[model samples]
Target: MPVERTENRGADELHRYYEVYETIGSGGFAKVKLGRHIATGEKVAIKIMNKKDLGDDLPRVKVEIEAMKNLSHQHVCRLYQVIETSTQIFMVLEYCPGGELFDYIIAKDRLSEEETRVFFRQIVSAMAYVHSQGYAHRDLKPENLLIDEDHNLKLIDFGLCAKPKGGLGYELMTCCGSPAYAAPELIQGKAYIGSEADVWSMGVLLFALLCGYLPFDDDNCMVLYRKIMRGNYDNPRWLSPGSILILNQMMQVDPKRRLSVRQLLDHPWVVKDYNSPVEWHSRQPLGHIDEDSITEMAVNMKRSRESTTALVKEWRYDHTTATYLLLLSKKQRGKPVRLHPEPAVCEDSCSPLDILHFSEDEDAVIVGSLDLSSEYIDDCPWISVTQQGFRGQPDGLTNNKNVVCEIWDGYGFCCVFCSKKDRDQEQTSENKENIVVQEKEVEIFALPLPRTPASSKKNARHNKNVLTTPNQNANAINSKPNAVTPKGKKNLLVIQQMIERLNQTMCFHRSRSLDMAGTGDSGKKKRGGKMFGSLERGLDKVITMLTPSKRRGLRDGPRKIKAQYNVTLTSQTNPDQVLNQILSILPEKNVDFTQKGYTLKCQTCGDFGKVTMAFELEVCMLQRPEVVGVRRQRLKGDAWVYKHLVEDILSTSSI
Candidate 1:
């Protein structure tokens, strides 16, 4: 029985159809509520999200919805309906009672090898189906895997999934997901193939399931990263040899050496007791209609069969289609996995009549109607006809006047042609209507293109510069010249030559300034050139200002204009704690600051209170797990002063 909703009539429209109950889960911008459909009394998880709270992540939500809509499999969570309002968006999804796989793993401490195999097979099957549909689940972990009432695994949370339109060779540039489950390439911020990255995460998940802990874990994020990069993990002795082999293959340091989802499906460990092999080549057509489901929907909605079928075929995001799919899913429960269904046989004894018309202008026969049955018409409402002639015409035809005509629909096309003279002969022949049916070839999946060594080296160097730790800065700078191309090297050489000439001119000016100072008024009178003397003095002043001081080298002067004036301080504490520590010490340093989340903008005086300095300090995760990075930015200040201020703050804080 559904709960009575008499609280409010104007607040939510979803309440009219679904009886919303207590919240089951919540995130930063969304809350999942247990909802029951009023019409069929079905349990559902309704995710309610505020548009404003979503901000830039709204596109990710839309992508998740699109990916869910494209996927339909037993091991994948189904998206039932989506409702949007002016300020909010609601997504109704399948409710799993067994909760997350992470909780299940924790409760059991560790799963047996046989149980792990069962779960791993299901995950591989789902991944195969996902890849076949041209999508990759970038975020694969125990937390994102849901379990149904029957203890079957169902993949969820496709917010980070990728389906590139640039085909299989396209590389994903986003560095996402948890560090424990992330691949080495992703951690290094390199462009990676979506499927390969997913495979690496799957390896991590398998390890966690078998051992009850992460393969790579450390309090220091940098240490954890180094471990993952080197593929260092301890395999339990209790694990079988096959399991260990598969793990090593899946978690290979090189993505190309990693085993793909297809290969994993056929692995000995994965297929040990799994008798049913996934049919990777089979593709279910989107326009497929189920007669039983349609009949049930028609009865439940109290509508005509034709109208229900029309609504289901329309496939819009409305109540009728949602109810139809939900009912269909309910009927499919406990059934054997069916990748390909046998062709339907017509019950009635009505032969398909072909209606043809001859076109004199084109000198060809056009097929007007191939199948007039209600089912065929409903499946493909539009028809496109083509004419193709056989190599040899029948003896009854004169001058090959009659041509074979073919009719095409959405699913497949059929050919039907005959001559009036040989109509009886054709009827006597075993094949009627000379019809030939041809099915469209469906592509299974695309593999990634091979990468060259040169490209790989270039990407590695670029990624190093993009995401480099303080310890690697010196090495990166030293090796930078080797990465330059011939053209870049030539340009650098030209710039060096110009700098040397400038240095020589400055040296000559300095010597002239010293001589002029010693000679004083007598040297000016000897030169007798006021313009040249004044220009020489101006050049000397400029050179003096540019020269390094005796106490500090030129490197300690103002930072290069092109160089970024940022210092990233790594802290073991959380972002909030590090932020608080910095905030606590700012007041003591006579700095006025404004705080926004983990970022702070500070204003202070530098250079003996003569220059006002302003800078920003941001505490961020920087993609490192359990580590915080305090980054500094000189918004309006001397770079040299900002650098010292950052140093002072780090020294004063306990972070």
Candidate 2:
């Protein structure tokens, strides 16, 4: 009889089943390499894992194999068998002759249209299979997707997979995904719906596939979340409509609103427009995937992800399973590389809730809601520009007891306009006479370098100024008799926003007005400064005249008014007139209204860093007859809601 060779259970003696091939990878677990079976004469791949390699995860090897077995779509790699020994476990799996999807993206910068369609189809197929099997592949990023010798996909990593029965809409609060790829619901620390969360990940993948960049691209996180919620996308005009349609439907903001896998399969981008929809795969409306392999592929699945069972170690009891892994060194084992963490500011700081309101550089401000549908508060003392800067108290709008402003705070709205100006940062000149202020210049705050939106941006040159025009005709009937109900009235807030922007144009031409006030040595007197050219007093009289007597005193000198106004508006002329004219045409609200609807709050509370302020009043042009030239009034009516915005330190006085 011929001598028969028997396999041994020891670590060193078990190398007989195959000849080791070159190393493919060595990571946190163990080294994996290509090998050829000694008796079979065919190529095979081996993943060697030490008993310690499994750590707390040792028992889950069976669960991994179980999930891998269930994930058998054309896009998912298959796990074949397990071998064991006292020292290690060798997992034999289907090897992808090709590599990772991330490499392809970096190498080509982006996927071409045809390439995207093909890859997308494969991804949808994989998603459908896993979901149908009642499982969710939570981590579906490009790197987790691999290609085979024929460029087929192999989605691996079963650690985060879960079944959909009790698992499907369940919330995964584990802040576990990458920030750039994370969905808004995830970042908010809200409960995340399963497959829907996966869809958001898919949306990110699609965006990167097309633009070679992220859609929510921003360094400042608060700003980034605002942009994401805005969802105003500029598609590269170059893309085809079919792809756009699919992406539009898949990326719906509401989780329940997104497309299902089967619906996505029927998507025009997936199947041609001429093709009919794919049939439901299950019998309960969506017939089950009545495939022949279903029964044959079934395996015992009492495997819990957190199991303490030593399944893989038990499999290692056979000699052949314990081969070459025993010789691999620790250095040969390492974790796979991952993307670097995003910048700190890019993480939690940004969000939709932080937007205090939208600024149009006009008459009244929209207190909240980005679309400006929220309420508009008007009639507060808006800063007016004079030759010195602004009117009201000589210190301009800086005086806290008088001046007020609104800023965004995340939770609700906090009034920041109440803050005092930075006295340390103020300009110091002994001359102080003339209530010295800044010169007027056309400055555009919304240019590309400082890059602001075109709609919000104005040119540096003065655009056409809107002169005060009487809207007497429309106002007569529309004011009361024709007065519409709240529903019928033009959004007063909208009207106010327009007025606020238009007001920018009316800023006073400081030097020109000082000439009218008086040009002489009287301009220099200390007592003279307040008593200057004015037969009455210097800017002091102007301050008192503009101050709201019933309440707070004067703010900074009027020059402060000019600076704030200039900073807020692009061109003071036409934009101003346009805003006022629009407001004048607005239908008045009916006094019969009884109930208040709601209040809008600033959304980005986290972005407000601590701040300082400054104020100066600039007198400009000759006094106006119609207007009080410049006037200040205490907070009243709807505007009172925002009066808390200004800081306590600001009082009616020149700093």
TM-score of each: 0.50, 0.39
Candidate 2 TM-score to native: 0.39
Tell me, by lDDT, which candidate is best: 1
Top TM-score prediction, candidate number = 1
Off by over 4 Å in 2: 1-16, 26-30, 37-42, 50-63, 84-89, 164-171, 217-234, 273-655
Question: Candidate 2 residues 1-655, lDDT tens each?
Answer: 2111111232223233444433444444555656444322234556666666568766555556667644445567655546665546676665665555654554455788888877777777777777777776667766667777667677876766666447666666655555656666766777777677778778777877776656666656688776665555667776788778777777677777877776777787777633754432421111222121122112212343223123322333232222112111111224221111111221121211111111211111211111110011111322222211111222232333422222111111112121122221112232122122333211111100111112122211221221222222223223443333333132222222322432331122223335545554542222222211121111122222222231122322221122211122222333234223322322231111111111111211123532111111122111122111111111112111112121111121111
Per-candidate local distance difference test: 0.58, 0.40
lDDT of 2: 0.40
- What stretches of model 1 exceed 4 Å from their correct place? 1-12, 279-286, 300-302, 334-655
